[model samples]
Target: MNTTEIFLLAMLLIFTAPYLVWRFCKTDYFAPLVIVQIIGGIVLGPGVLGAAFPDYYQFVFTAPVVQSLNGIAWWGVMLFVMLAGMELDLKKVWQYRRESATTAGFALGVPLLFGCAAAMLLLGYQGWMGVKGKNWQFLLGIGMACAVTALPVLVLLMEKLDILRQPMGQRLLRYASLDDVAIWGVLAIILLDWERMGRQAGFLLAFAVLTPLFRRLMARLGEDDRWYVSLIWLALCGFGADWAGLHFMVGAFLAGVVMDAHWFEQRKLDMLFKHVLLVLMPVFFLSTGLRTKWDAGSYPVFFVAGLLLLASVGGKLAGAHLAGKMLKWKQGEASIIGWLLQTKGLIEIIFANILLDKQIITSDMFTALLLMAAASTMLTVPVVQPRLHRESHAGLMQQASS
Candidate 1:
């Protein structure tokens, strides 16, 4: 009932939930631990069990607790971005430059077109229950959502499967990374009002012109013994962006990209990020789950959601697969790559949550997008692993014959 007691209880739950899940479930089910932590937060919050044990739940889910957890999540994302940047191999990208460019372009362009089209049709129908917005903004939002690819999840999967060092994996990772960068640029463009396009254009030109100078400054600062300088710079970037009407996360991401040139030591960055990922990333997803509120919207909304999910999946698969074929990949390998690239995991949900928080999309639309992300991720492993394994075996067999 007391503050200290509530804090203790929350800590107990956080520490024990993994153990409990592991004890009851198979080792393969460990991924669900992240989900459990999130659901636990919701159950213990004001939404469900909190209604019954008001005192205990309220104390546990206090504003301070939520804020603290959110801070951890943000740090986790920062580390994730850093790791992603560290993984960038300019050599590999150069090797597959044409293929990577084509794949990234198709992956992004197809989805953007489909999403915008869907938004136009859906927006005209005011009776559509779950959808949000009724004009160009809605179309832009939908297109943005559809264009997202979960770079963090893709990188983690590639690393886990030991494919990060492979040619195919390298290509996929490069394309995905470029895709993310493109999406961020697109987001910046989308978020800008038409009237402010000139201002945005000027700002972008200025940022571009200053990027080399900024990189040199970061490199110099990085050489200093005081690592806190990076943190200070990060804070200034994030706060400055917030003051300039953009989300802090955008600033954080751009900051990571800028600092990326200096932080090229993968091993050191990996060690730092591993801790952050294991501890703080889960909290971010948990907070996300806690904040999500799903309710029945209009039938049209549900229909549109279903359609949007289909369009998202299909567009990515078709576009990526076509690009792969154009690059002379075998049919099965191309299919596998397409499926792998189709996955939308925590990163996509994080973006959706940002849009939701900004009131750019409705709750129903958020729920639908979340569902799409979960489905895409769940489908990826099953679809790609077997095919890739077979290909690996065949390659080994050919080597033996030679």
Candidate 2:
């Protein structure tokens, strides 16, 4: 088949397989379509489908087809990350400064420590760290990956649980948003190449100067014009970041961070986010899968995946529990909040992809992190549902008595 036909076939698999599993299998209660799509990518990756049917895998995912898919994935993730940055409400965090800081700090800090310890163990071995990665870079990268919470996915899960408009939901969003900013900041630090220090410094300096001007221009534009302008801005920032030895994704986030979400209509922004997820992000997931490997060592991929999951989930819960103690949150709130905050959905995968691209973490590490992310995400709904239900029921009874 021609490359175009082959690419279409690859896309066909990407869209159809995940949809069937998510729709017919009714996995949405436990695993959302995004999580399912991620799992589908792993299933279709070289490690799984390729291992089982190398001939078919090679035939379908030819180099040209893979390259074609990659183009879509790159732009898709850039848009998605930008939207996530726009959704950040630093203003809200400021309003609840004390509570937000306490929660966000412990939530990010504890898991980061735990993940660092885990990375320490991995560092003792060969094949886990990337070619260009220093020990500190690998350690910090893995640690930050554990500390990540997918703010976008958290919003979806909260909406699914019908807590999206609630005070608790708002509180969770604040914590996740704060952590999201920190995650990217830490990534920029990790990606800092002393060799390219001059370029990186110039990019930051230019970004600082251009940000206000860009915001001013965006402010003056109509909503229709803003959308077009934002895309052009996204492209330029992405190019600039990549040229500066930082990843384009970092540029994408910076582009979004400076803009006000209030500038765009909420419904339109939400639709754009949804469309990006539905249409484009799946390709990113598949591309992520294409990069998965299991050649780390004698240890199996699932075993490594499990260890990372323990570190990530355990650290998150530990952090939340600490916050609950500090903030005097009621009983049962910690468990629910901790589980929800531990969700490492799209953002975790994105972070892992960056680590792989920067050669900070090996492909096996990426695969392990991917599994950790999917498992962590899937666990969120199941674990939180009962606690949420009990809380709701209790609230109703209390209200009735009052």
Candidate 3:
């Protein structure tokens, strides 16, 4: 009917469609609700649903409605990124510097190189690179996309595996956290606009000067006040970064990393994540899906998706196994760690979105990356659960023999 009614109807689909499939189909073991939501978004996007039912799709996903949804998605993801940043334990990462460095380095570097190779393969084809994107930027953007591990998603999967509070889980977080920092750093490099380099420099300088003062202010406030102030700060940093030619998510992350996690109540922080995912992130997924396209042809796009997936999984495993060899880890340890770190969920999509915004990657490339990320995430639990069980059984056998 009206725009308001249409927007409400769109929101209905965003929340309900995925939940029904996820719950009724019992896809939890392999495909979590988040995975279902992402797949649903793709299915509901212009390329699929709109192509199939143009009038119905256009009616529901009108310009104003899509814009509203995008605004919500932007804030939702920014807040999500902030939470991820707040979870970083730089102090602990430094404590185990050598081990963390080796593991994180291999985990990120090897996959990065593989992803670059994959990018090189795509260069021969048309419709993959964004017009505004330089050859090196496209390569590095694709490379980093493969190397990402969604720290928030990793925490959830580890919790599901009952390993989140374990020593190994802590180790995994350390490694992911370090990689998380590097991921954003690489993104900044990719998003660098030469014409706006001066503005970007000023943004960083201002950020460094402001961060400590902001931290001190946060420390002095009551928890309730801190939350409100943090939101305000999040908005301002996002604006500042966008103005400086960097993405707003970078600013949102800076807002979080500067604040001590201890400044907020742990239970509140948990609720923050829970509520954000439940209430907000689905819209982001839907918006991401709307941007997906088959411009590179379905076959080539899917083929590229397959290639990226292979590089992502293979490189992560190779890197992890190499780390295990150097550190003398137990049998089957690398398998579990490698599979777990291969996860690339919301963060990868967000990374690809940023690239798309700057015209680094075309819609087809975005779609392929989206597929690669969703498939990688969906594979994590199924693959790792069996490996964990097998590893445990072998450990028991060795103990009995002893």
lDDT of 2 by residue, 53-132 (tens): 99999999998889889999999999999999998999999999999999999999999999999999989888789999
Instruction: Give the range of the ten consecutive residues with the poorest summed lDDT in model 3.
Output: 292-301
Q: Residue 88 of candidate 2: its Cα lDDT?
A: 94
User: Against the unseen true structure, what C-alpha lDDT does each candidate score?
Assistant: 0.65, 0.93, 0.93
lDDT of candidate 3 over 1-402, digit per residue (tens): 899999999999999999999999999999999889999999999888988888999899999999999999999999999999999999999999999999999999999999999999999988999999899999999999999999999999999999999888999999999999999999988888899999999999999998888888988899999999999999989999999999999898888888888988999999999999999999999999999988424698899999999999999999999999998998888889999999999889988999999999999999999999999999999999988888778979989999
Instruction: Superpose all Cα atoms of candidate 2 onto the true structure and report the RMSD in Å to 1 decimal.
Output: 1.3
TM-score of 2: 0.98
TM-scores, one per candidate: 0.82, 0.98, 0.98
Task: Single out the weakest 10-residue window by summed lDDT for candidate 2.
Answer: 294-303
The list of candidate 3 runs beyond 4 A from truth reads 295-297, 399-402
Worst 10 residues of 1 by lDDT: 27-36
Stronger candidate by TM-score (1 vs 2)? 2
- For residues 1-402, what per-residue lDDT tens digits would candidate 1 score against the true structure? 665566556656665765476457753322434434444544444444555677766667777777766777776666565445445555666787887789888887887788787777766655322333336666776776777787777776777567877877877888888888877676665455455556555545555665687677666654443246556655655564544555566666666676664444556566666676666766676566556444433454457667787778788878877787677777577677777777777667767766676666766676667666766666676667788889889989989999
